[model samples]
Target: MMFHYYAVLAIAALSCSSTRFGVVNAQIVGQFSLEFTAVFKPAGIAQKLFTELSDPETSILQGSILSTSGLIYDPNNVAIKEVAGQFAGGVQPFLNPPDISADGTIDGQCTATSVNEEEGKILAHSCFFNICAIEADDCINFYSGSPFVYAPALDQNQLPPSYPGTIIGGTGVFEGIEGSVEVITVAGREFTSQTSSSGDIAQRIFLNTNFEFLERRKI
Candidate 1:
């Protein structure tokens, strides 16, 4: 009975020590960025017929699978400088010793929400990306919540080159994380025509994604 009483006291002491040291309710505070080139390819396309009074053109929904074997680079790296050069209309030189930091794929789907005479079609997209971190030897899944694409005259070229996107949540090291992503289309092609029922096209974009861990809830 005496030994049992001592053990109970010891456990209580350890608990108090942990509380005093601020071991509980620790906040994760910091941010990191990821950059990679992903190629977008059509995976599926479905047309939605207009049943109500609306535009004469048929609305279509499209799904795409974006894959990448491209090397990831730190924003401060020389390889990124080269990409920036290309963005600025300078010759894009090959990145030697290509810094292989990470690679990933994204699954995305978009549908027309509305059509305008001069502004063309407005699309809403939801995309999720899974990345393999070669340096950390881990993986993170980032969900880009709804981002809008405004295409004027039904031309994807009218879409914004750089747009704001959000990382609502993630997995792995990024579990319970949230932040913003700046999507920059370094190079892209027009999406398949709305009238065409079948075909595929390829395009590339550089995703500059940033993250910060969300405040952890107390147990």
Candidate 2:
């Protein structure tokens, strides 16, 4: 028998920043669903099995189940094209923001630029930071010192768990003009198990299904 499963993550942009140091709000919405069908065999065994397995009464007994154990991150945010442009005399400014928001909240900001002229065209500064609350009066801040490849088409699923993947690839200040960029693909998989029984006989099974990241543009 074969089964099909699907998982989706929906993101909604709450607002856009007004300036280079402005903040934005967002949400992380996720869902999971599964469909099961029995593979047919010769001599009507498959038809009989499917008929028996698909019955309202037996469907529950044979159907595969799916659940949301937990989410990787409740909410994450990444800033793209917020601060990018050429400086005076076409001196191309090194584009780097103060921080990147993973929880959809902006805490702090950073400023960065290219080290040289030629490097400015091929590379840009990629800085990111996050805010952590300490009690009600105190809070700790974190930041990324070295810049990374700046690619807006990518998303967190494409980068390391600690940072969003949307920041990977393209010409950036992190690496110099001569620096090289590499493209990579990342995917998520869901784990599932199934159990069935007929009369006194019973069986247990386990399976793995894959989920893909769909790119969405913020309007």
Q: Which candidate is the best by lDDT?
A: 1
How much lDDT does each candidate structure score?
Answer: 0.36, 0.21
lDDT of 2 by residue, 1-219 (tens): 011233533563223222212112212234322121111111211101112435544422111111111101111121112122221111111113324221112132223333222332212333332222111211112333443333212231122122221222211111111111121112221112222211110011111112121322221
Per-prediction CA RMSD (Å): 14.6, 26.7
Q: What is candidate 2's TM-score against the reference?
A: 0.20
What 10-residue stretch in candidate 2 is worst by lDDT? 197-206
Regions of model 2 farther than 4 Å from truth: 1-73, 76-105, 115-130, 133-135, 151-219
- The residue pairs that clash in candidate 1, if any, are none
TM-scores, each model vs. reference: 0.44, 0.20
